[model samples]
Every structure is written in C-alpha cells, then in structure tokens.
Target: MERIYLDNNATTIVDPVVKEAMDPFYCQMYGNPNSLHSFGTEVHPYMKIALDRLYSGINARDEDDILITSCATESNNTVIKGIYYSLIRTGRKSQVITTQVEHPCVANSCRFLESLGTDVVYLPVNEDGIVTPEILREYINPDKTALVSIMWANNETGLIFPIKELCKVTHENGALFHTDAVQAIGKIPVNVQETGVDFLSFSGHKFHARKGVGGLYVRKGTDLPTFMHGGEQMASRRAGTIDVPGFIGMGLAMELAVRNLEYEATEVRRLRDKLEDAILSLKDVLVVGRREIRTPNTILASIRGVEGEALIWDLNRSGVAASTGSACASESLESNPTFVAMCISDELAHTGIRLSLSRFTTEEEIDRSILVIRQSIERLRNISSR
Candidate 1:
C-alpha cells in the first residue's frame, strides 16, 4: 500500500533543498554564532544570508527583531509571558485577549496567565470559527488590555482570521497585537509590515523546514521583556546557542515556501477542492468552514454516524495519515474543540476529522486519499449500524 500523508498541518517533511542547505552546517561548519573564534566567525556570512532570507520572506523591517527559538511553542510562550511581565506586571495593563479556537500553546498560556491573576478573556468565535474585529472590540478595553493574541489560521478547521483588521483594532485600543502565524506563513502571504502587527510567531516544521527551529517577530520599539536568560546569543534578547543547521534550513524553507505561494493558491487549492468535493459527496458529511475563506490545503469534515478516531484508525490501516484535530490535542481522545467552539452539535463535533495538504501534495495522492476515506467511512458506518 502506498502511504499517503495528509497531515501537513501537523508537520511537514523537510524539503530536500532545505536539507541540502543545512547539511554543511552540522559538522563541517559547526560553530557557535556568538563565538569570536575563526571557526565561529567564518559562518557569519552564511548566517547573514539565511537571516536575510527570513526577513525577506516575512517582509519584516530592518529595525525589527527576529528572535530564533526552539519552535512555535517557545515563540508563543515568549510573547505571552513577555507581555505579562512587561505590561501586566508593571501595571501598564491587566488583561489579555485571545480567541477560543487558538492552538493549545496560546490557549494554555492564557489559562496560565489567568491563574496568575491576569485577566484573560477568550473571545468566542462565530459559527464560521472566526473572531472578527467587531467581536474583538466587545472584549478589548484600551485601559485594561495589554495584549491581544490570535492565530492567523486555525490548525483544525483551516479558517483564516482577519489579522490586519484585528491588529488595527488592538492598536487603536492601545494594546499590542500578536499572531501565531505558524499555520499561515507558507500557506498565505504574511507581510508583517502590511498587517502592522506588534508580534508574530511561526514554526519552521509547519512549512517544510526542519523541526526544533522557529522564530518570534517583535516589532521595533515593542519593549517586550526577555523570555530566556543565559548566554549573550540573539543579542541577549533570547538566550542559548543558535541551531545553525536548523536556522539555515528554516530560512531557505521560508524563502522557498513564499516563492511558491502562487502554486499553493492554485494547484494546492485545486487538489484540496477535489478531495473535499469527493468527501462531501459521501452521505452525511460536511466540511467545516467556507472553502473560500480557508487555507487552500486543509479540510475539516464531520461525518455523521462515524466516530473521528475510528475513521482515523481506519484510514491509517489503509496507509492514509489523517487526524481528528490539532495534533497536540490528539492524545486527549476528546471531541474536536474547534467544532465545539463553532457551535457544532455534539454528534457532529465528535465526528470531525481533519485532512490537511501541502505544497508537495499531488493530485494522485488526493484521488487516492478520497477513495480510502470513502471506503473507511462506509466500513465504519456499516460496523456501527450492525
């Protein structure tokens, strides 16, 4: 059986080009970027090139700070906690605002902040799983809100949020705006300057870069407090030695991913739509979120009378990789939270399964995946009805 991996949103296979770019950094050019020795300093030019690629990929300003971290989780934690220490702790503000459909990293950070006595408001998303600027205005108070964090694209339903409009609202209220763009960077055009966002977080693995590498984009003059404390690395903004290989790979990955955004929008979307249309042809199946508003590579569908985990297992047995929802929440064996947040019924909520694609996804794989999914659903439903 040919294995069809449709879980790109969870993580992607590192592009061969990116891997090749990073190979030399492992043992050949191994050096601490912060070291003054020749071995270390010699890597500077390559590092600079990588940094430039990263900046150009995001359209970030020269004066802005891009702090490399372990992954999007670290980047998220840094922005949330940094805001807590810098603004809320210092009496500048007392509350943080975020949507209910956020990934566990952002959601849990808010939950943690709540325990620390910071007012954390999880704004509800509409039936489409979107937190519009109007919804934000209802909860964000200029006097109390220190920061508002929202993800640019939902991992479960692939719903794209209105980042620019939401950021404008947050800024108008004198609060900083941050977005977890982990799912959005490669899938969409993410120009930080155009969004006027104060901070952004992204993971390299989500975009065909190696794991263990991600970054935080802090706008100039943001005054974010330090999240890590140790070496003078990252200009003392973020501590610890840099992952030179990971950085090189991720930078090139970002550049390449952005370069193929057109293909992502056209070819990827066509394949996704083909798969989605086939899934919808099945009885009692509905895709979450409007296809027009979602990222081109994702489909979260609810198949009535079929349990999500059962469907996932059946798909796996057929050599097709899929998920029930966010990979981070998969072990919990619970219903899809994003479905619940969108006010989907308990029955359909538990039936939600997500099939995400990537730039590398092929039309043949989509066709095969659709067949496997249809067979799996039919078998699962037959068993349950028996």
Candidate 2:
C-alpha cells in the first residue's frame, strides 16, 4: 500500500535539496568551527555563509542576535531560565506569566521556575486557542512581572497567536515579552523588529532542518543569565563547540522554507482545507481549529466514539500518518490539555487528531487520507456499536 504523511507538525521528511546542501559539510569540511587550525577554520567561512542564510531568512536585525543551540527546547530553557535569573539577581521582577496552551517545553520551564519559588501565572486562552492581549494586559503586574512567554503558533491546533499585539500589551506593563515560534517561523512570516519580542525560539525540524539544531533570537542588549558553561561558542550565550554540519543543515532548510514560504503555505493550506472539509462532513465529527485565525497548514478534528491513540494506530495501519498532540508527550495516554483549554468537550478531546501538511504535500495524498479516515471511523463506529 502507498503511504501518506500528514504529520508535518510533528516533523517533516528531510527535503532532498536540504540533504544535498549538507553533503560537503560532513564528508569534506568535517572540522570543528572553534579550532583556529587551517582544517577547522576552513569551515568557518561556510558557517558564516550559513549564518547569513539563517539570519536573512528570519529577517533578524543584528548578526549578534542569533544564538545557535541544541533545539527549541534548549533555546526555550535558556531564555526562560536566563531571564528569570537575570531579573531575580537585579531585583527587577519576580513573576512569570504564560498561557495554558504553551508547548510542554515552555510550560515545564515555567513549572521549573515555580519550583524555585518564582511566581508563575497561566493566563487563559479563548476557545479559539488564542491568548488575547486584553487578558495579558489585565494580569500584567510590572512590579513583579519578570517576563511573558507566549507561543506565536500552537503546535497541536495550529492557531496563530497575536504576538505583535501581545508584545505591545506586555511592554506597556513593563514586562519583557517572548514568543516560541518553533511552529511559526517557516510557515508564516516572522520579523523580530516588527514583532517586538525580546526573545524568540525556533527549531530546525519544525521547518525543514535537521533535528539537533535550533536557535534563540535574542534582541540586541537583552540581558540574560547564562545557559551553557564552556569556551567560546554562540558568543558564550550557548557554550560548546558548535555542530557545524547541523547548523549548515539548519541554514539550508531555512533558506528553502523562507524563499518559498508564500507559494508553499498557499498550496499546503488548500490541501489542508480539503482534508478538513471532508473529515468534518462526517457525522459526529468536528474540526477543532475551525476558527478563522488558525494556521494554514494545520487541520484538527475530533471523531467521536474513538480514542485518539486508537485512531492514530488505525490510520497508521492504513498508511496514513498524523498525531494526537505535542511530540514531547506523544507516548502518554493523556488527552491534550491544549484542546481542553480551548473548551473542547471531554469526548472530543480524547478523540482529537491533528493533520499537518507541508509544501510538498499533494492533492492526491490528501484525498487518499480522507478516504482512510472515513474507513477508520467507520470501523471504529462498528466496534462501538457492537
């Protein structure tokens, strides 16, 4: 049977062009960028060129703002921990504000800070999965508000948050605002200057890059505490010898994603909508992220009478790949709290499945997926009726 991949949100297959671009980095120029020796320095120029690729793609202002790290998880941890510590040491602020819909990385990071006696507040999001600016402004306590970390785009439901507006609110309250754009970077247009975020985190695999590389876009002169403890790398913000090949892969993947962003997003949105339209037409099925402001490439639906894991397995058997929620908690047999925060019914939350598309996804694959889901739901219904 032919296979169909609808799980772009979890990860995408490494694009061949991205792979081809990485060939020489590992095989030929296999040298640590930190070394001053001729062999090592040889890759320095390539790394610089790659930095140009990444920075230009994201429209970052100063080259100093981009700091490479292991993944978005590390990027997030660095930013959250760094800022929290920075504020505490300077007696600036003591409270952290975020939303319930954040990726587990951000959520857990906040929890960690709370463990350290730092105050943390989880502002609620609307039913459409949006954490509105007004709620943030209402909760803002500048005297104790250290930072506000919100996700620009939710990974599970694909709803795009209003980062720019929220940033304006947070700034008015005298709190630094940050956004985790791991899912938003390549799919939507991201401009650091335009968005006015103090820190932004992005992962390579979220776009077309390899798994091990990601970056934190820190606005110039945004003081923070240390994350990595080692010799010079990422200007000591994230210490350790950089993975030259991984960064190179990240650079190329970003180049492709940004260069073709408009064309890719438009096409993927068309395919995503077709799949969503077909699935929601079935009895007792609801598309969770049906709100107008949701992400273009994300289609979330709930099919009653079936567990999410069971649905995922059944779809897997039929050669259709999708997801229940965040990859960080994929193996857990728990319902997505993000959907729960969106006020989805208990029955539907357990049944939620997310189908994310990519630029390379085709109409035929989407149509095939629609058929597979219908069959799987029917089989599940028969089981339930018995």
Candidate 3:
C-alpha cells in the first residue's frame, strides 16, 4: 500500500531545489556568518542574497527587518517576550492582547507574561474562528496596551485572520502588532510592509526548509527587547552564532516555495475542495467551518460518533498519516482547545480529523484517502453500535 501524507499543515517535506541550493553552503561554502576572516566574509554575500530572496518571498523590502531564529516558536517567544520587556522598561507594558485560538507558543507566552506581573487579555473568536477588530477596540486601553499577538491562520480549520485590518487597529492605539505566521508563510503571501504588522513569526520547516531555522520580523524603528546577552551575534537581540546551513536552507525554501505558490495554491485548493466534497457527502460526516473560505490545502472533518485518535490509528493501519491538532502539543493528553474554542460539540470534536494536503499530495492520494476515511468511519460506527 502506498503511504499517503495529509498533514502538510503540521510541516512539509523539503523541496529538492532547496536542498540543491544549500549543498554548497554545507560542504564547500561552510563559514561562520559572524566571522571577520576572509573565509567567512566570502559566504556573507551568499547569505545576503539568501536574505534578499526571503524578503521578496514575504514582500519585505527591508532586509534589516528580519531576524532569523531556530523556528517560528522561538520567533513568537522572542517577539512577544522581547517586545513586552521593551515596553515594561519604558513603563508602557501594563497589558497584552491576544486571541484565545492562538498556537500554544503565543498563548502560553501571554500567560507567562501575566504570571510575571503583566496583564494579558485573551480575546474570543467568532464561530468561524475570526477575530474582528471590534473585539480589539473593546479590550484595548491606550494608556497601557503594549503589544497584540495573534495568529495569521488557524492550524485546525485553516481559517485566516484579518491581519491587515486588525493590525491597523492595534497600531492606531499605540500597541505593537505581532502575528504567528507559522502556518501562513509558504501557503500564503505574508508581506509585513503591506499588513502593517510590527513583528511576524515564521518557521523554515513549515515552508520546506530545515527544522531548526525560523525568524521574527521586527519592523524598522521597533525596539526589540534583548533575549540572549552573551554573544555579540544578531546585534545583541539574540546571542550565539547562527546556524549557517539552516539559514541557507531556509532562504532557499522560501524562494522556491514562492515560485510555485500561485500554481500550487490553485491546484491544492482544487484537490482540497474535492476531498472535502467527497467526504462530507458521506452519511453523518460534517465539514467544519466555511466551505470556501478555508486554506487551500487543509480539510478538517468530523465523523459523527467516531473518535479522532481511533480514526487516525485505523487510517494509519490502512496507509494514511494524519494529525489531530498542532504537532507541538500533540503528545499532551489535553483536548484541542481550538475546536473547543470554536464550540464544536464534544462528540463531534472527539471525532474531528485534520487532513492537510500539500503541493506534493497527488490526486490519487485524495481519492484513496476518501475511501479509507469512509471505511474507517463505517467500521468505527459499527463497533460502537455493537
């Protein structure tokens, strides 16, 4: 049986072009980007070219606006905690605002800040998991609002947030805007210049790059609170020498991912829609969220009366790999709060399975997946009836 992968939303496979691009950096072009020697300076140009490619991918014109980290999680932590500390030192941080449906990285960071004397407000999302600017206005105070951290896309349902309009609201109130773009970067365009977001977080692995590389985009003129203080690297924002290969691979992945975004997005959306249509037509299967407004490569469906974990196991036995929620917290026994926050009924939430397609996911896989899903649901339902 051919194994079908449908969890691209969790992470994607590295592109061949990205690997080819980073080959020289690993063996021949190996040099510290921070070194002042000739060997190091020679590789700096390639690194600069790489950074420029990433800027174009994100539509960020200023290269200085980007700060490379290990992954989007670090980016989120650096930005949320970094900006919060900066505000506190300036006597501006009394509270921070974020949505309840955010990834654990942002949600937990806010909670950590709250634990240390700062107030954190978790705004609620609508039925479709949309956070309106009205909710921002209702909760924000001009005198003490320091920063607002929100996600660009929901990992479960692929519901995109209005970063552009919402960021405007936060900025107008004198609060810095930060967005976790981990799921939005390669799947969609994320131009900080256009969105007016002060800080943006993204992981290279999410976009076909290496696992240990990601970045936080801090807009020019924004002061970042220091995270690491030992090494002189990263202009003192974060310490230690950069991962040369990871950085090169990340930039390569971003460049190549953008080249195919337009074509892949159209095709992925077609395949994803077909998958959703096929599954939802089955008896008692409910397609979650707005049918057409979701991500191009993701489909989250609820099989009425079956459990998600059980369904995943059966599908795996049948040669399909899937996920229940964010890969970061998948091992935890806690229920997925994203579905709960959306108010999906306990029975439905228990059975909700996330099938995220990718540029590499073929049409045949989708067809085979539909059959497997139908069989699994039927079997599980029958077992329960017995």
Model 3: per-residue lDDT, tens digit, 131-239? 8898888998888888888899888888888899899999889999999988887777778888988888899988888788998788888888777666777777778
lDDT per residue, candidate 1, 1-386, as tens digits?
A: 88999999999999999999999998889988888998899889998988999999999999998998999999999999999999998998999999888888999999999999999998999877799999999999999999999999999888999999999999999999999999998999999999999999999999999999999999999989888999898989999999999998999999999999999999999999999999998878888889888999999998988888888988999999998853323667555557768877666667888899998888889888888898988898999882
Q: Candidate 2: lDDT of 95?
A: 92
Off-target runs (Cα >4 Å) in candidate 1 are 326-330
- Those runs of model 2 whose alpha carbons end farther than 4 Å from true positions after fitting are 325-332
Q: Model 3 scores what on Cα lDDT?
A: 0.83
TM-score of 1: 0.98
Q: Number of the top candidate by TM-score?
A: 1
TM-score of each: 0.98, 0.96, 0.95
Q: What is candidate 2's lDDT per residue for 139-172, written digit by digit as tens?
A: 8897989899999999988899999999998988
Candidate lDDT values, in order: 0.91, 0.84, 0.83
Residue 188, candidate 1: C-alpha displacement in angstroms: 0.6
Query: Of 2 and 3, which scores higher on TM-score?
Result: 2
Looking at candidate 2, the ten consecutive residues that score lowest on lDDT are 325-334
Model 2 TM-score is 0.96
